[model samples]
Target: MTSNMKTQVDDQMVLLSQYYPGIYDQLIPEQGEVVKPRRRRKKNKADGNSSMMRKRKLSDEQVNLLEQNFGNEHKLESERKDRLASELGLDPRQVAVWFQNRRARWKSKKLEEEYSKLKSQHDSTVLEKCQLESEILKLKEQLSEAEKQINSLVERSDGISSTSPCSSFSMEAMEPHFLGGFGMEGLENVFCLPENNYIHGSLDWMNI
Candidate 1:
């Protein structure tokens, strides 16, 4: 059948099911585009005969025992599963399904914890890196200031040398003046020169 014709038929079936809720399953086949089955009243009834097919809630004691087993091993041998089922008064199938669900939840929780730890470590490392970068910038600024101070000192030294009259005087020429308080006579005797000759020689040197 064409697409349009198929849609029309599906619509009609839906209208019929709404009117007659009881015979909807009988009217439709299971082959193409099957409709969802309605909840059966028989299954929902609290009867002992169909209770085995329904989900069974585990008690606190049973849950604690199962968790203890899971702590030991994620997988259980068939014999162990049967033993646990007998002890808990549950079916072997139910015990197996419980283990499967518990293991999945445990694995998910472990992964989430590991992710949080790694993320914290990464944040700490990033913070340390930023602190180090800030320190380096401050050190660079201090070094730049020191360099500027040294340049200023050098410029002042050059200016003083250019302006001072005795800037070109050697250490030998300045030594006598520095020791003059001892007496010019003592200085002349130390150098073996007469006072007048020394004075005239110093004057001629200064003129040159």
Candidate 2:
């Protein structure tokens, strides 16, 4: 490089050093040793191979034996786990994990059964309540019809009395067919009350 260009470069570096003192030492150290950024170590072959390892499928005979042992004891003792692992030619951890998985499946199944039973009972109770409500609504509709009949009877009786001063009410005309359960004697007594007393008195029968 030319002398003038080198002088200009040195002057620019000096100005940068004034503004950032630490950056100048990294770019141009006093002893002239170059600084290299530390590199991260790559993963070992063992770690890479461990991730690629495939799961081994258990033999039919091994599965059957495990099922038999699980049925007898849902939770195995440590010694029993080691004994089964030895017999099956497998690790103790594998035997223990199998039992854990089996227990989890069993617990889930039991919870589902319990939930199904409770849901069935709740549905039945709701249906029974709906049926009872429907019955009550029907009875109310029947009672309304009966009230209209009673009002008609009272009007007919009142008209007859006004027309003939000496005439007595007909026994068959005054008898309410819908209220046959109530004795004719009790019904006749209420109607026998003179004047407008009978109209208000008839309301007593509906109190039941």
Candidate 3:
């Protein structure tokens, strides 16, 4: 061993010697001796895990009764745990552990139910929004078609108006009444042409 390592071991020995009667003054470690304690510790940890996994499971009747009790109350009071243990032919600790595991499963079930409800609501909202957007797009398409026809009729009216000096219709004067947001009905209201003009589709012509 190095001088620093020897000094550390000497200090440890001196400290332990007061409590431990058998202490070695001269120390020498074999090749594998340093690794032995870690191997023993690892083996003991494995044995502890194996023992925990070996716990006995309860019977069907015991599980059903435990489920009924859990449905009635989530918590296991000491008095109730003892009574349940006696009735189910189990230890109180076993009953407590079962209830603890059952409560965890129950909480997960409630969270799943809540998530499903919220997801359904979100889907419904998305569907409604799509429907509204489709209707708005359809209206916009209809309005664009109507505007094209109106422009055609006004151009025809302008030729007839120039020959007859009494006619008051012009594209410039009609523009102030035209609004994009107000659909085809507003277009009909804006165009107050005389009965001598040609009639278009369903545009209820009357004097302004």
lDDT of each: 0.68, 0.69, 0.70
User: What is the descending lDDT order?
Assistant: 3, 2, 1
The per-residue C-alpha lDDT of model 1 at residue 164 equals: 66
- Report the C-alpha displacement of residue 152, candidate 3, in angstroms: 3.0
lDDT of 3 at 35: 23
Please state the error at residue 43 of candidate 1 in Å: 10
Worst 10 residues of 1 by lDDT: 183-192
lDDT of 3 at 76: 95
Residue by residue across 98-120, what tens digits does model 3's lDDT show? 99999999999999999999999
Pairs of residues clashing in candidate 3: none
* Among all candidates shown, the one with the greatest lDDT: 3
What candidate 3 gets wrong by more than 4 Å, as runs, is 1-55, 158-208
Ranking by TM-score: 3, 1, 2
Angstrom error at residue 33, model 2: 50
Per-residue CA lDDT of model 2 for 16-104, tens digit only, reads 44544455446754486765433334345556466443446678888899999999989999999999999999899999999998899
TM-scores of the models, in the given order?
Answer: 0.50, 0.47, 0.51
Q: Could you tell me which 10 consecutive residues in candidate 2 have the lowest summed lDDT?
A: 183-192
Root-mean-square deviation of every model: 23.2, 20.8, 14.9
Candidate 2 — what's its lDDT?
Answer: 0.69
TM-score of 1: 0.50
